[model samples]
Structures are given as structure tokens and as C-alpha cells.
Target: MTKANLLYPRKERVRKKQASPNFKAAGKSIEQRPESINKRDNSGDFEIDTVIQTRAKNECLLTLTDRKSRYQIIRLIPDKSADSVNQALRTILQEYQINSITADNGTEFSRLSDVFDPEHIYYAHPYSS
Candidate 1:
């Protein structure tokens, strides 16, 4: 039977807080991504994301996935800060070739341009994830 049919207590939905207007991406917008990257025609093109450990203290996973091959690289980072992300990427991609990276406008990704080329970095629109 459904929870409603069982007379279970209703759970309240928590609304997400609004994002600040002052926070902006430090790199190019995703709209400027080349057509080859958009069509997943390139191998080195990647998308980046972070998986934070909500219950843990200062631990997260930084991920990069190739758009065409879906190959993924995961790294355990100490924190969600931009510096941590940049360091992790540098260590993870030392021997690899990169074309471009598309990431959300998260604070942890603010320093992406420092790790990768500024011209090769693309940021998704705010709240567009």
C-alpha cells in the first residue's frame, strides 16, 4: 500500500535557497562551446562535477567524464573548495590531453580556468543544471 494509504506522516519538502547574483563563472559560457564539442564528436571534451559528502566532514569526489566515450575519472578530494578541485584535477590529468571542459557555476569549480586553459573552459548557466 502507498504511504498515504497507510496514514503515514507527511514529509515536508524543503525549498532550495536562491543563488547569489554576485557569484559568476570565471570562464567562458557554455553557449560559446564549439559545435564539435556540442555534438560529442571529440574525445578530449569533458564535463566536470563534484559529489559532496553531506554527512562527512571535508570530503568529496571530483569527477570528469568524456562526452563522447563516457570515460570517467574520479578523484577523492579533501574539500569542496576551488583550490582542492584544481589540485585534484592537476594530479589526475597530468599525463592526459584535454580539449575542453564544461562545468556548472559552482564555487568549487570557480578555479577551473587555473587548472585548464581559460579559453577551453565552459560554464553552464546558473540554475540550469
Candidate 2:
């Protein structure tokens, strides 16, 4: 063994700790969401997220997925602001029968409950899926 290995005595490998959430979730937290949503047996429970293709790209994708059926819906938007996302969601709700939604607590979704009823929407806590 090298001098450094001898000095360290080849200790056991250290386990990496899971990263904690950096951002705070506002409005209803994942904990407050109904247990039934976690079951993922019934339809109408959905999760939504925004995807930016690249930093230079001005447009973003609004993604919605049904937790039960795994049905995905994607919409392209010129911007990822709260107003744009809220309008996209409004259009989607007109087409989909979404009973409840789980969304990340991002700035784009800050006013989601204003667009949709707070009772029908749940924001996923930070560091969560």
C-alpha cells in the first residue's frame, strides 16, 4: 500500500447522503394530499411539470401525466411564465377530466390554484418527484 493508504488504513467506503430539497413548496404540500392519490389505482389523478429543452430555448414544454393510466399530455409554450402555464392548464382541463393534480412548487406554477381550484390541486413537496 502507498503511504497515503497506510495513513488512512483503507477505511470502509463512505455512503453518499441523499440531497435535501433546496426550494420550499408553497400552498398545499404533498403531505396534505390524499392517501388515495398515492395508491395510483384510480384515474383523473395527474402530475404536471414544465420541461425546458435548453437554456437558450425560449419555449418550454408543459407536461401532464395521469398517475393511474400513465397517459401523458405535452404542450409547447413560447414562455414558461405562470400566466402561460396557467393558460395551458386551462386548455388541458377543458379536454381532460382531471379530478386532482400533483405539481412541483415552481414559480411557473405559483398561481396554479388561482387558475384551478386549490381543493383540486396538490403541490409536491421539495426534493420529491
Q: For candidate 2, lDDT tens digit of each residue in 1-129?
A: 675758557667888554366655657778888888999878999998999978756899999999998999999988989999999999998988998888887889889987788887788756456
| Reference-based lDDT, each prediction | 0.88, 0.84
What local lDDT score does residue 126 receive in model 1, on the 0 to 100 scale?
Answer: 81
Question: Which candidate's lDDT is highest?
Answer: 1
Best by TM-score: 1
lDDT of 1 by residue, 1-129 (tens): 766786776788998766688866678889899999999987999899999889889899998999999999998999999999999889877867778899998889888877788989999988776
Candidate 2 residue 49 Cα shift, in angstroms, is: 0.2
Over all chains combined, what TM-score does candidate 1 have?
0.80
Q: What TM-score do all the candidates reach, one by one? A: 0.80, 0.77
